[model samples]
Target: MARDLRFEPHDQPAGGWGSVRSLFRHATNAHSWSRAVPVLPKQNKPGGFMCVSCAWAKPAEPHSFEFCENGAKATFWELTTDRVETGFFADHTVSDLLGWSDHALEAEGRLTRPMRYHAPTDTYVVVSWKEAFDDIGARLKAFEPDRVVFYASGRASLETSYMYQLFARLYGTNNLPDSSNMCHETTSKALPESIGVPVGTVRLDEFDATDCILSFGQNVGSNAPRMLHPLQRAAERGVPIVVFNPLRERGWETFINPQAPGEMITREPTDLASQYHQVRAGGDIAVLMGMCKVLVDRDDEAREAGAPRVLDVDFIQEHTHGFEDFISRVRASRWDEIERASGLSRQAIEAAATTYLNARRVIAIYGMGLTQHRRGVDSIQMLINLLLLRGNIGRHGAGILPVRGHSNVQGQRTVGIADEPHLVPLDRLAAQYHFEPPRNKGLNTVEACEGIIAGTVDAFIGLGGNFVRAIPDRARMEPAWRRLKLAVHVATKLNRSHLITAETTYVLPCLGRLEVDEQATGPQIVTMEDSTACIHASRGVAPPAGPHLLSEPKIVAELAKATLPSNSRVPWDDWVADYGRIRDAIEETFPEDFKDMNRRMGTPGGFPRPLAARERRWNTDTGRANFKCPSSLNASFDADDDPAVMRLLTLRSNDQFNTTVYGYDDRFRGIHGSRMVLMMNADDIIRLGLTRGGMATLTTVADDGVSRRMDGFTIVEYNIPHGCCGAYYPECNALIPLSHYAEGSKTPAAKSVPVRVSAQP
Candidate 1:
């Protein structure tokens, strides 16, 4: 079936009656509405399961309806009544499934049993669990210790991730490539250098007292709907909220508080942003520089006029180093250069600076829009600079917040999952487990792809996430991925990667976040870390989707038992029997972070891990906070002086989460039944000689001598910055080369890809 594309103007406020209807619709469609009647109230409450969607932090007290529209969609989808059983596989071939859309493939339902791909028939057949484990163990033993890549997703719980990393390291390899390498690798790399920690400084409750909020590179309404509550409250209290993005998002403009009874009946949404600036793609560095310049220039004038200084001299002198050099660089940045690069006039930047100066307690929040670029690290550091100028760290209602994508991505990293072996103190793990971990650095996401392409990697095992569809340059990676000797995925549902089979392909069914996981010690509980670094216990209340499915921790432990040496001291079976044993092991490994993790898990809101930056204690090399001084504002990508070239930004639609497409409609954007559409400014559409609904092909402007094109995309004129266009991901991911990444971080620059739009023949 061909996907039908439709377009219309969406002018309604985000998250009002529309969201209520969407939640009800998806719940019924997934056959989970009735189940949710009992399960929904249990979500995010104390000792309850957290939503398996985005990792937005929950409030201390839970409301009757704590989950958002997208959260409800995720819950219902995971606990759907439909099942992909043996008969379902008999009905569809891998070849036929390959032709279906991502949404269609997912809608086929959950996998009830383990499956293996048969090459001759190009179909997946049911396989016993023992056979699957034996095949995987044989393949792993056949390959060199370093020839296997153990990939993880943010969806993995901390207990699962810890066991995975320990198993890989004990097996004499550290080739752990994770979803974080593709998303917030910039934040993980940059924050430590600036603030002496790789985590955010704010808590969930700080939003209540914030005087100003600056949101950059994130669509708060669609991505993290729970954030809308705080944004709406800030707006109601007349706190200035500033938004910076290439496109004017509807959620940032106005939002209806779904929890409020009067607002839902009246449909009168609260106005959100006091100011919205459509900054050009990859222009965050320039905008930051412009804001800093305004502050520095104003401070100098204040000194001359005998007024109060704008910069926080006391905080800078007491806790920071390298201020003089940073101030000099900010002062030296010319307004013309800032204007040209940022695509905003000096006056507008000054207005934003005024808002920043007026607020003593400010919060700066950003998302992947800033981190998914070649200059991502620089952008993250620049935000810290802006916050540090006002002494925002360790203050009430003031700090830096990097909104992450996955539910437990930050937690996964916290529990020791990294490409760099040195990031975790291996001595503690080695002493605890009685094995020496690999000392050398391992392959990151890009390096892992290169290793597969070069045939240096023999086996690939994914704990979670759709690897092939989630990464960049699918055309290149998919073929390389298929050549691997062994491929195993522990997932709940069907996805594109499962269809892209290897020589020995196995799909092992695993329990979802909302399912029961029974072991010898009875039902188990898993722990996850939210964006704010709060570690909490999550107990699934719903029944298991399938009787045969295993928990993620169990799957990892069983795989380790099959592959590891017989004399290994890791106690895999014992940990699998009781997850409390896993938490005990985790506590023993990271004593400081999880000293009393088991006891703390019983706390009402759980416990927050130690954050050195939150206490204004510097843990950097110099024992003080450092201000980074990047030389140039120019992007890393090669750009021509041609005015015809436009930067293409791949963004998520309102109805989507990462690559998970819940439906065909993007209600917030007024887009229906279409994922193959480009959002362009009216002036840009006219300049390219294209009318609304006209077909166009987006060709990559790369010097690699290889051409990448996405064809048959309808053009939709939108309220976006000129010289920039927007499209959805996994569709436009083909146009991005794996080499186009942040220099040190190796994160794919998915946000800003230079391209040309031409009419399709």
Candidate 2:
């Protein structure tokens, strides 16, 4: 029988007044304030580890408090007073912990030592580090290297990532699947095909030169609050910021920067968007296509009258390929079809296009909403095409910005955490490590889950991250996780992933970025790459809460030492003892701009990675950036195919960052007490004969009859687009089938899922 789970609702006090009271109380209470701030060293020097929460990148500026609310929460949670010691695990069973909520489990506090689950006792028994490594090594040795998968999270450092990829290649497996494959894979896949580089081309300083900012599917204030300052500056300078989203997020409309004292004290906020359009979910591609088509038409008319084309014809002719093919498709497309599919009239599209035309420099910013659809790659390509219509590719203020989620996710890909069919890092590994690397393709996150379910994968090791709960098909995935021969997690705290134990499971505690890592060679520095392709160093100032806790680099090195044979060429011990040696290995293998990495990174305001932005060079095959045409202009899903189903888009709450739920309340969205409620258009709710606050059932329309129908969920009437509905993710992950994913990217289509809503029985 399924276990009964219940959650209590926590009510929050009203607005700015409540926040002021809480701040005052927190400051006055010595214990509260001290406990909140993680104990740190008195050094004025900045740390190497980037903030693991968001993608807002700024030079390491000197400030009283460099952390944000979510960053603070992450740090506090990592360096909490509570410790999940051997005694605690001995007292609780894995099954019991599995019944706990995600927030509650993490709140239980940090893990101190290595633990191994004993199935006979049905409890987690503490094990010595040596014994745990020996057992894990034996199990790993039993399987083929290709079958053994290694997963890395975005929080990993560049040195750690380099070492991990090196170890994997030596062990003979190309399956270096990571968190990026699920999030920004579309951007990485599409941007490079169009612009010759996979990263965003714009810098923060470029905003000053930009006349217009076209933002799509990105919620800046909530996701990356630091970005709001530049946006606020742009707005103040009379630059028009256009927003396109399925739902009207408050952050997009207005924002209050907590960093500014006057604004915080006065409760004054800055207006963000000049024009906000609530486009239908999955309709972004069509909308972009319409705007591009309009530009082409206008340019054609000017050219016909002996005037120069509105678009940069010289740039297109010189830099791009496939222009004629793209032009033919755009000319053949009808305005009526584009308007109907996009849910935007011809006049509105024309007005939007005019803004793009009038602006001297424009930046197009997008997030997961554009990349979590069936044709996500196509959608990304369309956005790139729009930027390329003008000479935007190699310009300062004009380019593409794919707002990444995890702080270091971009870094992970840069260091070779990929399942690329070609470009395997193993070839370099064989030369460096003197071992035959695995050549066979390995499983991605989704495939890894499937492998476990099919009983093909016996051992699972996660470097860091909430694997089971983060993936879709939760009901199916949780069971598969339990069947492993050995399940090992290197984590900072207790999460849902820890409880999913095997016959023999281990939880190895690791030091967080905020906590100081004491190595053989003294303090170690870690590096992370930002969204803008800037590689910077992070150093930990705070002492670790417990001495037993090890750094991620140390843990991986120890594990590799125990697993690899004596003949292995990789120096596992040397790499962990001093991170500079690891960086040297990276420099030798994949030689880039960071030659004297340590010296350059130590300089104030860490160095930039090798990007075309700094040089104004396009690394495409033709010596310039290429512009490709979108495959199709159709954006609307065929609702007639499933008449009863309503399209559902999964979202994150304002109080939350990614899968970590800091609280139940979403203050900005006006949601309180519950996360199970669905936001819908009031007109759509009334049209369907459903009353506000009414209970409803949402069924998936698929052939498998796998219906995740929730009956008690409250229906909320909100200002969403007519055909769209919204629900918080990880909770609504049950509704998304594994098969329903992006075509080229293979990322789960969490932004677009068809569901049918009905009154509760």
Candidate 3:
């Protein structure tokens, strides 16, 4: 399965001619494009299906074309005509299939029926859904609650996630860990401590009123294409978009609106960033602190001159605490240290800060680039500090926005799919369901993997993600999954996770967002919360790929009924029949957040959830927006100290979404027909004596005394910061150690792995 790797430097902006071509090609490859093309217009429409891609908010007024290239690709990929029937598995054994690339494995198409792994033949055999549930129930009944781990994915709806958490709690364990634990868990943990809320405070329409947008560490164009719309509009309206990232992404510089007829015909793309700064990997804290220093210094000068106060004095006195301590740390930070750590000159940082100070309304946007680091929590806090210092929060057109990757990852967390048992009030759950929910915190993604390795885990259930592929240290995690007594996955298509089997394995095929989910009552529509905190209903208009496929709620409820006793107080069957009942339970659990969930979802545009941070009503321990000052303002890594070791950042390709591979081509970054490639700085490539398109092996640097290496990766000279390199995730995830994580939030340091690259042996 050798691929002919191709690289062509792309000068055009993202979402112009290249995006249109790629969209059609992928849609055609998914099967008959004509049959699935109609589904695109319906996506993100009022009461229509939501894009399975990134969770950017659905436009208030639906457009004729509502989806981006990747969003269309997801709809087509799910509505693909290629079915993985019994014959497909019979022809390809699990051992044989493991050798295939991720694209090839999923390209075989949608799973048609429930499957059970027959270890003797090494092939998946067909099984009844009832039989599968009964088997899962038998295993759960045999094991202690603490020994079972329940995992959730971002692709799931809020209904499914609530059902999943409820099932896990009713089973007597709080072992609920989802995809959030891997990506934005740091934001979830740090924002509440800093600003009295877990999710971002800005509304979707705030982009229109924002005067300046400061983006940090995220490739906005590639990760969420729909976001380019608002950014483009902002740029056109004279809004200054200051971007800070390691690589020069085409999306950050310029983007073409595919919806514009003149632009599509002329191929004229709009410039996105007014000023772009290449902040080195793991240098976000330094860059942020430097910006804060400039702001504080300006504020001091303004006070001396008796001009308008620059530091939001009135707001600080009324709504904030610990600002004095934060300012002291910022003022004491030396310019030389900030410049050295941030890989940016003081002049550039000061200029950026000047823009921030001048703007009346500002929005700070960040992604995994800020979250996946050794000091990720500190980096997030520093960003919040900048916004707080200027009183950007709780105002019109200004706040903090964390760009969530998954469609409903935020919604899942909102509805109680988390490792922390106290995330949802347990007393309410117990009062409504008539069962005592567990009080102890449970295993998150990382801890769950460790628990499996330590032989403490007996059963593993995945709601809707490629957990093994998405998590770090696959060499250890994969084998640990095999040791589980039982493993269950509720999925729509075949993926690498299904191949990694346990003693008892079941793959229950479920409905995709674009497919109609007909239950006992009738067709059901699920609700999801977008990144901007808007809750909307998503109803599938197309027919199911297979008649046997069940909705995620049905699968979860059947399993609950099979596992729990007859006297179990939860109304699992009624909830499964109509999803409205599930929302009723959610309202009971989260009365303040989801009051009248059904009614709100019926509106043209869904209701916005209450954000205390938006109203300056702080929910922190101090009852004020707390400024968390770091002990030191230095970068986590030393650039001058480690010339031989380049920091490796794990990223997603333009054609990929999370762990799902749409294709091997990363057109925006000039990569083609390969996923096993690394992007390195030209200077570092020459220093390592490596040439473009040459093979290299990466060895992880750790103090644990064990060596982990990923062999045979092709290196490409890229426009990146010196001493830093980048590679796509799930491929480079193995090089990340589970122990290497942010101090407070245990998120894997995927973006900042110290690795030594050498010529392949």
Candidate 4:
């Protein structure tokens, strides 16, 4: 048996260096860090250096230092001291690189040159830029554009993503898969169907006016730390912030602003969440339904009497449709059933509803936790229903904010990286570029992986991202990657995906957003869309880390120039030479309300992209917002569950972002030095007859017998609900079967995997 490792709790005051150090030790895998040698800028113009971490909009206020811990880590990783030139590849085989961990490979330093895998030698060899381009062009010309997949990451600048989609469409394919597939694709899919828009309805400034803020499953401090300020301000204003999650996150309870001198000096922190409810995993849909049912019941009683209706009937009548049907469904839902499913008492539900009813303005923010469920889309729709009851959509301090994960994931979608079968953006490409693009619907991330596994996808081109590690079923994904004919990655550093080499693989290093890119047309400005659909220009302040590092836009342009025929009217060189021209093309292609893309993006504090919510204008066919009834009430839970299996929820460590593991410590959870421990309720352990520190093997109860047996996992009894178990993601991703995903969103039900756990022998 593995030794029971015990962690000593520290009572140091929050915001103190001791607390910070403790958090770092636990979250960072206790790794020693060499302080970065700060590089003073030669020029201090407001260059476009966007934070590569989160989607927090760049504030109008100018500060001496304005970077979060994650942002600084992103910057350092991009501008690291190490370099992996051709010589490094000469000493390592593809097989050897495969054996190294993702962190170890990237820690070897940045890739400085183009290198290609030689099948005979089983090693990567240096290739000149010209030769590399020629090889890519030849391979591209051999297949129809639909056969190729163009995947982009959120880190890619707006300028680069726009050019990438344009090039792919001009080459006659809508095979544009992206990172959004992994995170907020549900928000994009569900919001449009319900509200006629695909973005957050509230602006950042709206938080100031909000009376009550409800956050479901979003860890604001770790994912988007800058949001802490707005949340803190809301708390200062006496607004009640309610949080509902399966686990208790310290950041949500109280936060000490690292930026404020007073707080930093005194080690004082402000209380954030007034009420924290630990809802069962995948129970959000039921909880939301209960809230709506309460509202509906109250409104019906009010209508029966001479009193005014509790619901905003005017807003429902004027701007929304199908409210009557939605109300009927909400009223029919049983409170007893809702309570059983949600694992929250009727008093708790009523208290939460009372807060919402009393508040004049309310904002509900959520993260991937709400979306990574079987009924993810339905859950979002229900949240919309609750907000719509009070007409919160277009109000100052009220709306829904789907906190997106990547820096530029929203930007990629804005620039047409989509697989919408009906609205492929290819027809618009044809009208603008005078070429008929492919009309066939393209593959999404899941489909792309399946295609690779089935041997239909011969070549893969990643604009940016660790595709293999990010996807589910890694055991299958890695082998599928090996079966590919050609795999190419345009990246800033090495990652797990690079190790999943094809027969012939190429690693082309690219410039980071913070690094300057000098092209034939001179320095360029990149644009990015924030979570609120605000588009802003980003300029690189520092020099490129290496001479061989190319900008993503320039790389895409050059690749297109090499691949496409001379007769193609896309103007690849012109767009690469000047990003403004690319913006002009984007403006021409998607002629929406705001078309002066370059000029508007240059404005200070940036400008909000054209959205119907700003003006309460619905773009739906009926010209009004629509209300949707969930197809089924028990959509989130399994209809037929084995009595032995319990649902597992996958989460991230405070120090980690997505699949990027900065360290092994989760400070907020009081976890240190390891991520192999599972959090469960004490009652649950007693009920299952499992002891603390007992090793458990989790197996998914799927029909395919595709169970994942993770051994030597220590069980730590915690405050989670009885029926749910919590474990860190990417590590626990193996327990989530890909086939058990949401029907409409296709999002992996990472938050709810029905699994059976027993003591490991």
Please report the candidate that would top lDDT against the real structure.
Answer: 3
lDDT of 3 by residue, 1-761 (tens): 12577878778898988888988899888894755787777888786888888898887876679888888888888889889988988899999988987788888888879999999999999999888988889879999999999999888999999988888988889898888889999998889999989999988789999999999988887888888998999999999999999999989898888888899999888999999999988888888899999888888899999989888989999999998888878888999988878889999999899999999999999999888887888999999999999899999999999999889999998888888976778888888877788999999988998899999999999998898888888888888889899999988888899999999899999988888888888999899999999998999888888888888988998998888876456788888888998998899889888999988886655688999999999999999998988655543544457678889989889878888898888988888888888888888888899888889899987888867899878888788998889898888888898898877788888988989999887
How much lDDT does candidate 4 score?
Answer: 0.77
Query: 1-761 in candidate 1: lDDT tens per residue?
Result: 11487677788888888888888888877777655657887887787898888888877786778888888888888888888878776688888888998888888788889999999888898888888888788778888888899999899888999999998888888898899999899999999999998989888889989999998999887889888987887889999999998888889999987888999999888999999999988888888899988888889999999999999989999988888899889988898888888888988899999999999999999998888888899888988988888899889899999998889988888888888987887999888878888998999999999898889989999998898998888888888888999999999989999999999999999999888788899989999888888888889898888888988988888888788887456888899999999999999888888889988985666689989899999888878888887656654354737778888889888778888888888888888888999989999989989887888999988888877888988888888888888999877889998888886798999888888999888
Off by over 4 Å in 3: 1-3, 32-34, 634-640
TM-score, cand. 3: 0.98
Per-residue CA lDDT of candidate 4, range 544-606, in tens?
778877788878888898888774567877888888898898888776834888778766666
lDDT for residue 680 in candidate 2, whole number 0-100: 84
Better of 1 and 2 by lDDT: 1
Candidate lDDT scores, in order, read: 0.87, 0.74, 0.87, 0.77
Residue 107, candidate 3: how far off, in angstroms? 0.8
Q: Is candidate 1 or candidate 2 better by TM-score?
A: 1
Whichever of 2 and 4 has more lDDT, that candidate is 4
Worst 10 residues of 1 by lDDT: 631-640
Candidate order by lDDT, highest to lowest? 3, 1, 4, 2
Which segments of candidate 1 are over 4 A away from where they belong? 1-3, 635-640
User: What's each prediction's clash count?
Assistant: 0, 9, 0, 6
